[model samples]
Target: MHHGAYPRSISNLPLLRSTVAPKRPIAHSPKSPPSTCRHYRQIPEEEYRRRLAEARPLLSNRRAKTLETIGTTKQHRTFILLCVAAAVVFYFANSQKVPVTGRRRFNFLSEDWLTIFGVSGDAYEQELRREGVRFAPKYDWRYARVMGVMQRLVPVSGQADKDWKVHVILDDGAANAFVTPDGHVFVFSGIINLCGNIDSLATVLGHEIAHNVATHSAERLSAAIIANLTSGSLFLLLGLLPGLTLAGLWTLTGGRYVQSLIYDLPMNRKQETEADYIGLMMMAEACYDPRHSIGFWERMKVVQSQSRGYEVPEMLSTHPSDGSRIEKLTQWLPEAMEKWQASDCHGGQGAIARQFRDALSHRRFMGVAWYIAVPGDWRLSIP
Candidate 1:
């Protein structure tokens, strides 16, 4: 007699209950990194937004959960499943073994493409020079010094001189330095100034040079291309899912999407480690103090700390911090020291002559020039 169906509205309301699936629980999506990296944008925000939008249509049907809304997005379970699938396919499709590390990797790359790209890269640099880029003798000194270092340390890459013509330019305001294939190295005057010494300069040069020897640059380019192609394919396939979020797509791809777009995962501390070992060897071979590496890395760490982690696009781009890099370098020190010593370090012998003798023993070169060269003899003459 009292209840009479409870006025229907009260029965249907049920406090804090579902009105169309309980507000969809706001859903529990994962916190995704930015849609792209900071390096990809010269102007940043506006340009980034523009590019993301252009790529958005690719993810058009994907759910759009921002970082704030991430907590409620329970949709990660589905994403995890898709991620597993993507991971399996990606691992198999891109896996490769590095010649140096002999470590198999999930990177899409090959030396053939590297050489091809090198041709174009060389062309591009020549164009820049043609467009009025001048080579300075001091920077040329930097180039020769760096090249000389590689020749002494990295026997495999030491002969880069034979095929790869070295180039250097002085960009006084440039805050960065980079190396291109075909032995072209660009150094900024600002970098030289900040170096404070040859050791600092050697550290920077060694890392860039290592990228070439390890084929890391080629690996980077391959990953970048694969990332784009895979992301584009994912964008299309995502429309088929229609319920997933953009953040969901990013994490599922294992940061490849951002890596492809903005380049976050391009060079982590791991690759930096590889460079450190290779670099130290090169420096030692050049008869420069391997101790310089420690100081150079320290300076970078100091600069990073002073900046309070607030720097430019590099912070948000491919690089890890100096602190992390220095720590990793520490781990490699004992091993690197052993290599330096095994090469007859401590000025006990001429590093170049020792290197040539070792090369001759390997039967790789008949007459090692640094040890066997005569001032008048252009070629090796047997007694």
Candidate 2:
């Protein structure tokens, strides 16, 4: 408010300031002109080296631990050696000879164990009843037809003393027949229709019976156990390698598929072939014409072609090809014919003998005798 002279309070007041600031010129040192580098606290060389040395051991320990987690070379070698030794011991311990074929194979299941826990015929029959599956009555023609052939084959099956029971299942969709080790035979209606005659039916029945006689089910179970162990071991071994895991191995290896292709399928095919051989011999010894087997297999081949529309390669299939079966049957026909001729089938009190007598009696008493035009064909005759 005062220009030159003012009031006492006004003269003692603080000075008024302007809003704008005045500019100043910058100065630079000659030796280090306008330094822009960041400043840091300096450390002593000895202290830094000591700290680095201490950290090296920690880093080394971490690296060693990671290596241990993935398994070292020595550990892997030791584990693999142990696996080989265990496998060798297991193989030798379970080695046994197959009946009839005399082929040595691995099966660790004992007879007592098989009896108690194995597939039981009586139990299976009860299960079928529970499931409401119908069985052909004993008085039915199919039942009699199956029984007649089975009776003739049983005496020569090497287990005649066993309480053998045959049931004809009313399933027309399943062209299959199977027998339990305890002498229970199940014949499907579809297979009966497929057989077309008793001799061909005998071929099918003899094959199924041979499976029981050979104890293939128990062998298959044992093989499954071995396969599981092998697969688990393989997965574990693969996971121990660097950058691998069980899930990864499963995805990459297709473990179950590999095991089936390598072990299970081949084993099944082998068992099937052996059963074919044994069944052929058994049918021949029972005085059923063995040559019918070849024709039956040819018919089976045609059926399979129509149903599946495409054939699976022999390597991938559980059973051998129909061609393979026919070839083997043809090769074995000479021996089968010799056995048939030696049976003296015309004079015995066997099922075939009874059938012959019935035929003759029908001709004499009824003045009419039905005969199958085909040599190996089956036909019913009443006396």
RMSD of each: 22.1, 32.4
Backbone collisions counted per model: 9, 0
99-215 in candidate 2: lDDT tens per residue?
A: 556677776553334566566777877877776677898888888999899877766665444567888888776667766655677777877899999999999888876765565
Candidate 1 regions with alpha-carbon error over 4 angstroms: 1-94, 97-104, 115-119, 130-133, 137-147, 150-162, 196-200, 233-263, 266-269, 301-315, 345-383
Q: What is the TM-score of candidate 1? A: 0.53
Q: How many backbone clashes does candidate 1 have?
A: 9
For this target, which candidate reaches the highest lDDT against the unseen true structure?
Answer: 2
Models 1 onward score TM values of 0.53, 0.64
For model 2, name the residue pairs that clash: none
| Count of clashes in candidate 2 | 0
Model 2's C-alpha root-mean-square deviation from the true structure amounts to 32.4
| Residue-level lDDT tens digits of model 1 in 1-383 | 01010000100011111122344557789799677745553677988788887774533343443533333344744564565566556656555545444455444433444556544446756665665655566336665564554444444334332244444555554445665544555555555666777766767776666665655655556555555555544543444344246646567977644453344333443455666666666665555666667777676555545544454343343455566566766776676666556654332333333342333222111122222221211111110
